[model samples]
Target: MDELEAIKVTFFQECEELLADLEGGLLAMQDGNDDGDTVNAVFRAVHSIKGGAGAFGLEPLVRFAHVFETLLDAVRSNEVPATPDLVVTLLRASDVLADHVSSARGLGDVDEAVSASMAAELKACTDPNAAPAPAAAPVEAAAPVVEASVAVPAAEALIGADDALDDDDLGFDFQPMTITIDEQAADVAAAAGNVWTVSIRPKSDLYRKANETALLLRELARLGPIEATLDASAIPPLELLDAEAAYATWTVRLETDEDENAIREVFEFVDGDCDLEITRGEAVATDDALAALLAGSAPAPAPT
Candidate 1:
């Protein structure tokens, strides 16, 4: 696709992911669940947005992303530890970035004061010598990137409110049906039932090492038997690499009677992390998994 097409696709995909990532970061920070994956996830989203904006010659976006990327890099590489204070700062930054994304689409300019506050907060979080963040930037030398990570006691970490969620809360309603897949799809497909195909394309530079396509396919298995055909037509040579972004798209055919809501739950945590479509196929007989799923209590055993 051309730049315009790519831009449209990226904005739609990026917005979902950015918010999901922000949610994860907040949850991790609040729960004291400082896993590398959570931090890396947030960083990768910011990094990809910055790279794309740079390619499109969007200076205002590029500028904000540059500073934001630096902060995320620090978090990802463990330069600065994940602190409650930093998490709050990042959340505020997320709002600013959201505005930037909107402004890119001709929404309006982000408030100058909001932008200024973000700039000041970012500097304080990244710099040790800087006095507490004021309403303006300081006239000090740039902070050098530290080599080692900071270790903090778990008890000292800041916490967030625990938001409870269950499968039902997540829109997982198991409605079973049967759909047929093409005979030629046997190689990619593991089983045959109600077939549903999904197409996924991840933002470039999403994964640090392996592309998310393969990783993404593995995760799909949790929902049902999914057949994924790699579209390597756009695949570039390893030498010309944007290893972070995944250009390869997959046509995944899943065999199950799972309803759209049930199937959609598979990609919930990854909202905005991918492009997707789900379509039905030929029908067949199936059990009432939905009845069982929707039933609050189990049926009583037959009298023996």
Candidate 2:
């Protein structure tokens, strides 16, 4: 391969690792783990990528990376400082970045809108006192809402899920939603920094290979307190059930000190083998709300 091609390949490989670390590092910071080395590692990754992109003259990549790298440097030098808002913004920028790279690889500029939005957001995030860097405008939309209503995408600095559906190449057939939590699960969740409700459907190959849905729920229990409710409401009984298919649907209330990521980590071994949706839950304070205290604290009064 030519030098440019080699660099591109390495860039892509290293970038994937970098992005993963960036995300994990950001998450760590959110949970009050401010490790300077983690922040430095993320900053270096962006800086290196920007420098390399500049040498290669990939304008789009270099342009965005310049702004992104600036924000990283700001955080690294403690010029801007990391706040929860900054962490969230940075994470969203990471998504916009995924869109940018996809466009670079010929994904048809699907994310120009997002890129512009993030660029504006980043500009506001850096310190005015720091040596300033060049800026890029957000990508413009051709058919913007009206002839006169173009809201400028502002620039600023740094910041910064799951649903499983029967997804085809074109659209999706959403499965039913389920929620559950047992007393033991509540205790576990109360102990943890957070808990989440997660639902998953096994992949097509999973059923054919004898993967048991029940077993997945049981395994999830070990990570913390877990109560599993079977959503067999969709199941057909007796002779009508598909013998080879997975019949048990589950809704789990998991309690743990784990962050959103750690909650997702429980399903690590089964990834791509199943579809999952996990949302961070509202912080449940006090155990009386979860225990079977029907007098006044029974989760909206047991649905009447």
Candidate 3:
């Protein structure tokens, strides 16, 4: 196959894996394991699919995935509860999403009515008070109404007479800001001279997306002196290896007074795409102890 065709094939293959993860995570939540990581996994799956679809100009697939993702984001941010009804709706939406992927691959056509119906259901989960669009309502017609209703209030708030408005007038309470600084805390941190251990294990998708490990390491090095070790224990024999799969992980010992957040900022863009942890402590006396600490802690499974 040509390069474009090959890339398209790879994207669909990744979609299959992501869909499996999405389904598995949803099932776990259904079984009462609704943790933050599980919610993040589901969000990442849809997000990756949407990103790939957009690259290929799969407009319909992207559009539906975008709506599906918005609802998932609400659940992630705790704006909406992961109630039984919402989970059921999300699973049904996932099925439709799979159909959308198939249609994008030219396997078959998705009925407009079915897609529209599912989209409306997903939208309802985002706004509990909002009703699903009538089945007879045209998709284009219903979409504009929803968009306008949401946009108008925001526009009015910005342009409305500010003198006439109070904190309560906006339908939500507003609190004044406060800021304080503790010089003693800063002095203690500086005096402690603590070091941090940063562990990172990136999934294959990170490389596939052209994220450079070298760049991440360089960024970390900027924060302080870093001794990095690459672990290739997971690599298979050459003949058994898949070129696209990631098998290596990294363990880095950083001698920096930077806070944990500073270390995490190096990996913020890839927050959900990899496994990362930062812990602060006194510097280790030997490399072996650091290695043992790194090896003893099992890395979270990389994104599927």
Superposed by TM-score, candidate 3 places the C-alpha of residue 71 at a distance from the truth, in angstroms, of 0.3
- As for candidate 1, its clashing pairs are 17-272, 30-160, 177-257, 179-194, 204-244, 204-245, 205-244, 205-245, 206-244
Instruction: List, residue by residue over 64-132, the lDDT tens digit for candidate 3.
Output: 787788789889999999988788888888989999999998898777778878888787776667556
Candidate 1 lDDT, 1-304, residue by residue in tens? 9989877777647766776776677677667877888777777777677666555545556556656767777887888887887887887788888788778767787775677668656766777664442354343452332221221111122222334545554454434322333334442332444667777776553443112344345545655555466677787888986655577776766656567776775554244557778776522212243234335445454469
lDDT of model number 2:
0.59
TM per candidate comes to 0.41, 0.40, 0.45
Model 2: per-residue Cα lDDT over 1-304, one tens digit each:
9987887878767767766777787788777676678788777766665555444434566556656766876788888878888889888877766565566656557455566567667867874453232344564542211211111112122211243323352245433323233546445434554667777767664544233455455445555556555567767877897766665555666655656765665554344567788765533434445434433345444354
Q: Give the candidates in order of lDDT, highest first.
A: 3, 1, 2
- Where does model 2 exceed 4 Å of error? 1-3, 108-110, 127-304
Error of 3 at 61 (Å): 0.3
Arranged by TM-score with the best first, the candidates are 3, 1, 2
